[model samples]
Target: MPKDQKFQKINFDLINNLIIIPIEINGEELTFVLDSGVSKPILFNLSDRDSLQINNVSEVTIRGLGDGEPMKALSSKGNVFKLGKVKNYNQDLYVVLDKEINFSTSLGIPVHGILGYDLFRDFKVEINYAARNIKLHNPDLYKHDPHSKSQTLRLSIERRKAYVEGTVLMENDEDIPVKLLVDTGSSDALWLFREPEKGLEIPEKNYEDYLGRGLSGDIFGKRTKVSGIKIGDFELKDAKAAFPYRESFGFIKNLGDRNGSVGGEILKRFNIIFDYARGQVTFKKNGNFRAPFQYNMAGIELQHNGLRYIAESIAGFNGVVKSEEGSFGNVQILLENKTRLSLVPEIIVSGIRAGSPAAEAGLQAGDVILAVNGKRIHRYKLQEVLKMLNEKEGKRVRVLIERYNKDLLFSFVLKKVF
Candidate 1:
C-alpha cells in the first residue's frame, strides 16, 4: 500500500439504472448494488450452486419499503470485506434466506447483495454515471474535480442515509421546496409523498404502476411526471415521477421531514460526488443530462425464469485430414456447420397491468417468453428485451410464449398511459 496514492477507481456496471460492483466477502466474490439509501450490507439471492462461507449468523426481523410483514434475516458479524485494494475487517452485514427475494431474474444478472453508508463514510466517492466507474478517494487526500458548473449541496446524514434539498415544480405552477432522500438504488426519478395540504399533490393524469421491490415486498404506486425540479443551478423538466402509496411505503412517511427521494433515474443524468465525511455532495451535468426519460410502455414486466438449451451452428470440416482413408482415391468431404445446443437464460412475463395492452392481448403472468417480434429472447438481456418493447408508444410487439406445455402467440400495441 502506498501512502501518497490519491484515489482508486473501480469500473462498475450501470444495469437497469442500478450500479453493480464486484465485492469480496471472506475471499468469495459477489456482485452488489451500491445503494445510497441502504445503510448496511445485506446479502441474499444465494442458490444451491453458490458456495460461500459467511461467519457469525443470528436471526433478526427487519422491515423496509413494501407492505409485507417484517422479513426474517440473519446478521453476520466479524467478517472481512474487500473491493479493489481496500479492505475492512470485522464488518457486520445481514443476510436474507428467502429464495423468492431475488433480483437476478429482473436484472438479468445475479444481485447477491447491497452495500452503502460504510463505503461513503470511509471514502470520498465520485460516481461518474456517464463513465460507468467509481472513484474512491482517500479522505485526507481528496481533491474535487474541476467543474465551473458544479454545485455542492449539503448532505444531511441521518440514520445512515443521505438527503438533499430540492424544489419540485408541480402541475399547478407551484414550486414546492422539499427535502429529498438521495436514493441511488431506486430506478425511478422522483417520489413525492402525497400531502395535498402542503402543496404536494398527485396529478389527475396518473396511472397505477409497479414502482419497485423493497425489503418487505413489491411496491406499487401511481406514476406521473412533474413539471420540473430545481436542484442548485440545474433544472430538470418533465421528469418521470412516482408517488408510492402510503400503504406500500409507509416507513418513508416516518422518516423525519423527508418529503421524498431523488432516485437513480434523475441522478444518472449528473456526475456526482458523495463526500459523506464532509457532509456534502457535488453534482455536475454529464452526457445523459439532457436525455429524455424512457419508460416501459408495453405494460408487461419480464423476469428470468431459468435456462433452456439453444442450438447454434458453427462451420467446421467434418473429415479427418490425416487419418482418413478414401478407400481407392474417391474422397467424400462434407463441410457443414455443426449444430451445438447450449444453455441460455429464459424470460417469463412476471406481471401485466390490468386494463393495459398486454392484458388485453392475453399475455399471462407465468407465460415463458420465447421470442419477441421474430427475435429470440434467449439471446438478449432483460433490459435489452425491455428496450425492444418500450422503444415507442405505437410500436407493435409480437410475443411467443410457452404456457402449460403449449406454445401461444400474442400481439399488442404499446399504448401511452397518462
Candidate 2:
C-alpha cells in the first residue's frame, strides 16, 4: 500500500486560507477566523455561546450587510487567544449574537469571530491573498523594500467624515490617492469613487443609490472604471471600482490608520511580505493577478429584495437591444455553456416604485411577470431580460405571471429613458 501523505504541520508563522487558533473564553478554548473585514474586537455568534460557557449577556448594537436595525450582541472578558507565537492571555472580546451570521461565506467555518486592527496594530502584518498566507512581525524593526518608499498621509472617508494616516508609493501618482481598506475577506477588485467631491464616481452615468452590502449595511454607490492606482512600488491602473458613497463608520474608524485596504485585487498582482511582528506590509509589484470579471466588464453591481439579485445587463451580440425579466435570485446554477451561475428567483412585480416604468404601464405591485413576446421566460437572466426590453423600446410585449397563484398575462409597452 502506498504511504499516506502526512498533512503539513499548521504553520503559525504564515496563515493562508483559514487557520484554527486556540482562544479561551472564560478558560475554554475555541476557534475563530482572523479577519480584517470584521472591523472590531473579537465577536462570537449565539450558537457558539453555549459551548463556550458565556454566562453574561449585554445588549450591544451591531451592524451588518442589510438595512435591518442594529442587532443585539452578548459580551464578556477574561478571554485568552493565541495566534502563532503571540498570546493574549486575558482581554475583553465582544461576542455578536445571531443564530446564523449570513452575508458572506468564510473558508468553510461558520465565521465564529474576527480579530481586527486592534490586535494588529501591536504587530507588523503581511497577508498574501494569492499565496494564502498571513505573516506577522514587529513594525518598528521591519525592513523596507529597496524599491519602495513609505510616507504617512491622510485619507478622508466622506461618509464617515474621518481620515487616517496611510502609507503609499510616491511614483506614477494619480490625482486621487488610492483610498483603501486593509480587508482580508474581500476577494474582489478595489472600490473607487467617481465624484471626487461626493467621493464616488459611476460609469455610464448610472448610480444605484440603494446598492451596497459587506460587513456594513446596504449602501448607495456609483459604478465606474478605474484607470488604476499606485502605492509604494506597486500600481494597478485600468482596474474597475464599485464606488460606494456610503458605508458604516465603525470599520472606517477602526482602519483609519491605513489609507484604504490593500486587498487581493492589487495584492495578487505583487509579491508581498508583511512582518506583522514589526507592523509593516511590503509589496513587490510583479505577479499575474487578474481582477474579478463580469462579462468582460470587471464587476456586476447588484441589489437584492431578500429573495434575489436585481440588475440589468447589455444584450445581444452588439451589446445593443435589451429586455427585462426576473433572473432567479441568489441560488447557484450551471449555464448550458458550462459556465457557473447564480440563478435569479421567480419575481412577480413586488411594489412598484412610485412613478417608475412599470407603474406607467398600469403594472402594479404583486403582478406576476410570466413571459415576454409569447415565448415562455426560460433560461434567461435579469440582464438579458433588460437588454431585450431596451432593444424593443416603445414596442408592446406580452407578460405573464401568477398572482394569488392565478396565472395572468398582460401587455405592457417599454418606454425610452434618456
Candidate 3:
C-alpha cells in the first residue's frame, strides 16, 4: 500500500461509552479498547479461542486504576500491529497472564487488549462517535478543515497521556477551573480526586458506590452530579460524576497538578479531533450532548461467564403435504426442522453495592442471570440489559438467576439516589 494521505475509516463497537476497535496482532484479529489515558498498549483476556504471537518478551508487573495488587505481565518489543492495511512494525506491548483481570466479562465482548498513545502520536485522529467511525489523517497532508464548526482547545501531553482543562461547577453552581485527564477508557462521566483544600470535594449528597475496575483492583467511590462542566463555549448541565477513593490511586503514581479525569461518559457527547503533534483537541456537539445522565439504577455490575450451548428447534423449508377431507378443500402441511444446539452467552452478576436496590432485593454475586424482566438474558446485549434496569426511577424490575442448581427470582423498584 502506498503512504496515502488518509487511513481506512474504521467502524468501532461502542459499549458502555468506551470505544472498542478491531486490530490485528501478528495477523490474529482481536478487539481492543482505544484508551487515551494509557501510554503503552496492554494485552490480556486471551482465551483459548484466540491465537497470538509475541517476540522479545520479558517479565514485568504493572498497576492501574484497580485497588488490587500489581498485575503480573510480560513485555514484548517485536510485534506487527495493523489497523486495516496500516501497519506498525515494532509495536511494544505488555501481556497480562492473570485470567482474573479479563475485561471481556465486564464489556460483554471478546476484548483482547487496549490500544493507546502509540496509535495517536503519529496522526491527526478524528472520531465521529455518533456515526461510530474513526479516521486517521496523515499529519503532513492533513489540514484543519476550513468549514469545521468545532472549537479548538489546548491539549496537555504529559507522561505520554492527555489532559484538558475545564471548569467544574461547585455546590453553589460557581464554576472553578480544574485540569482533567482525558480518559477514554473509563465509563464514568467525571472522576474528581478529593482536594477540599482546592475547593474540590465529594458532594454532600453522594452515595458510596463501586466506581469501576482499575488496573490494580476494583475502585470504590461516591456517585453524584456536578452542576455542570464547561469546556470552550459548551457547558453540560448536571453531568454525572464519581469521586474514587484515594486508596485506589496507587496504580497511578501521581495525580500531578490535575484534579481528576473526564471520561467517555462525557467525551462521547461530541465529535472530536486529537492533534497530538499540534498539542490541541477540538470538539463539536453531537446528538448525544443533551442526553440525560443515568446511573445503574439496579446497582448491579454484570460480566460474561463464557458460553453455554442449548438445543434450539428451527423451521425447515420442506413441509409435509396432506389432502383435505373434501376435494375442493385446501391442503394442510406440518413440518419442522431438526433440533440443534446453539452457543449463547452466559451472564452473571459480578458485583452489587451494599444497600442498593439489587442488594436490598437479595441479589448476590456469582448468580447466573437467566433472565431479566421475563426476557431471556441471551436475547439482549449487555448495554440493553443495563438500560432496562435504569429505565426510570420507580420502574419495577424482575430477575431470574440460577445458583447451586436452584433457580431463584428477585424483584426491585429502581430508586433515585441523588
Candidate 4:
C-alpha cells in the first residue's frame, strides 16, 4: 500500500503562461507557490494570522533583493494541510506573521502557503521546464525497468542534492557530470557550472545577456544551449541554460561537494519523486500532466548600478537606499581590541539573508551594525567586513549607530539559522 493513497490525486495545468494549484487554508481557498527550493512551507496572510494557532515563536530572518527587514515568525504543528489530495500538517511548518503574504498582494492569488520539501519527500517529482508542467507519482506505482538500466543514467538525489552519479544512457550528451541541487522554485532557465572552472561556458551563437536577481542581488549570466540533459533514462534536448561568471558567487565555490542547481525550467516534464529520507529522487516521463492554472516564479528582483550606503539610512539623506549609488559615507570607530577601523557607515539592511550570523542575532533593517562582535567596522572593504562578521556567531556584539544624528547603541546576540 502507498502512503495516503486514498487521497484524490490533484491535477495542475497552465493559465496565462503560469502554473497554479488550488489550495485551502483555514477553510478558505487559495493558491500557493509549488516551491521545491524552500527549506520549508510558509503561509503569508494577515487575515489568517489569529487563526493560524502558532504554537512556538522563533526569530527568523531572510536575505533577498529589496530592503530586508526583520519580522516575527508564527509556527505550529500542522500535520494535515491538504494540497489537492496530498495532506501535510503538524509536520513542522513556518509562516510569516505579517499583514499579508507576498503572493496574495503581488500575484493577486490567495496563496495559502508554499509547498516545499516536507510534502515532496514522499513522492517522485518530474518537472519539464521546457513544457512548463509537473508530474507526481506514488512510489508503489513506479517501477524501474530492468532493461532500461543497461543504458540509463542515474542522478543521486539525496538530501536535496542531485548529482550525476553515473550514466544510464548517453546518446545526446552535452552536460558534463556535475553535482546539482534540483531547485523547483527557480522559474527561469537553468544554471550550469563546473567545480574547477571559475568561468562558465555559453553558446557561441544566439548568446544574450541573461539578467536576473536572486537572494543575493543583481546577477548577470551567460546564455547557452545544450543539446540535452539526460537523467535516469530521460533526456531534455535543445535546453536553454545560463552560466553566471561573477565574484558574487564565491560561496557557490564552497558548496564543497555540490556543483549547481537543477531549476524548474528543466524539471517540469516528468512524474517526479523526491525522497529526502532515503536520499533518492525518481522521475518518469509523462506528457499528459497538464493544468489550467498559472503561478509566478518566486523571486525578488534587484538592480545593482554600483551604489553604496552607510547604516540603514542613506548618508546625508532621510530614507533607505533605493538605488545603486557611487558612494555613501565614511565612519571611523575604535575596535574593542584597540584596533581602529574605518568603513562606510551604512547599515546593511536588506539582502543579509537568513542563516547568516547577523540575521541569527535579531538584527533588523533600522538596527545599525557598528562592529562585528568586538571588531570595529572601519576602513574595510565589503568583502573584508563580511569575513569579519562570519567569524562571530552566537556571540554578544555591540552595535553603535547614528540614526538621525543621535548616537544609539544596541547589544545583539548573534546566531546562525541557515
Which is the leading candidate under TM-score?
A: 1
Which TM-score value belongs to model 4? 0.51
- For 1-418, candidate 2 gives per-residue lDDT tens digits of 0123211112321122233344444565555555555545556543424566544456566666443456667666655555544556556566765544532222222335666555555554554444555555555445554553433233333332222223232223334554565454444445543344533334453434333344344544544445565564345555544555534334333533233444444445655544433334555544354543221111112222224332333233342223434322245443344344444444345343334345555656655455667654445543344344444456766666566767776665655332
TM-score for each model = 0.92, 0.52, 0.91, 0.51
Over 4 Å off, model 2 = 1-33, 37-39, 46-50, 55-58, 64-66, 103-109, 138-174, 193-200, 205-212, 247-262, 271-280, 290-418
Go through the candidates in order and give each one's C-alpha lDDT.
0.85, 0.45, 0.84, 0.48
lDDT of 1 by residue, 71-121 (tens): 899999999999888888888999998887888878988889899988998
lDDT of 4: 0.48
Could you tell me which residue pairs clash in candidate 1? none
Q: Of the candidates numbered 1 and 2, which has the greater lDDT value?
A: 1
Look at candidate 4 and tell me the lDDT of residue 333: 46
List the candidate numbers ranked by lDDT, top first. Answer: 1, 3, 4, 2
lDDT string for model 4 (1-418, tens) is 2365632455554321235567665454656677666656676654533454444456665433212333467565644565665555555667665552344322322345666676566665544434554555566665544333223334455554445442111223434665566666555545665333533345554233424434444555555555655565555655556666544364343555554556655555554545554566556555532321111111111111122233332234432323322123344444344443444434343333433334444445444445554665544444344444443455555655445556566554544321
Which candidate do you rate higher for lDDT, 1 or 4?
1
- What's the ranking of the predictions by TM-score, best on top? 1, 3, 2, 4
Off by over 4 Å in 3: 146-148, 309-341
In model 1, how large is the Cα lDDT of residue 100? 77
Model 4 worst lDDT window (10 residues): 295-304
Pairs in steric clash, model 3: 65-214, 65-215, 66-214, 66-215, 66-217, 67-217, 68-216, 68-217
Evaluate model 3: give its TM-score: 0.91
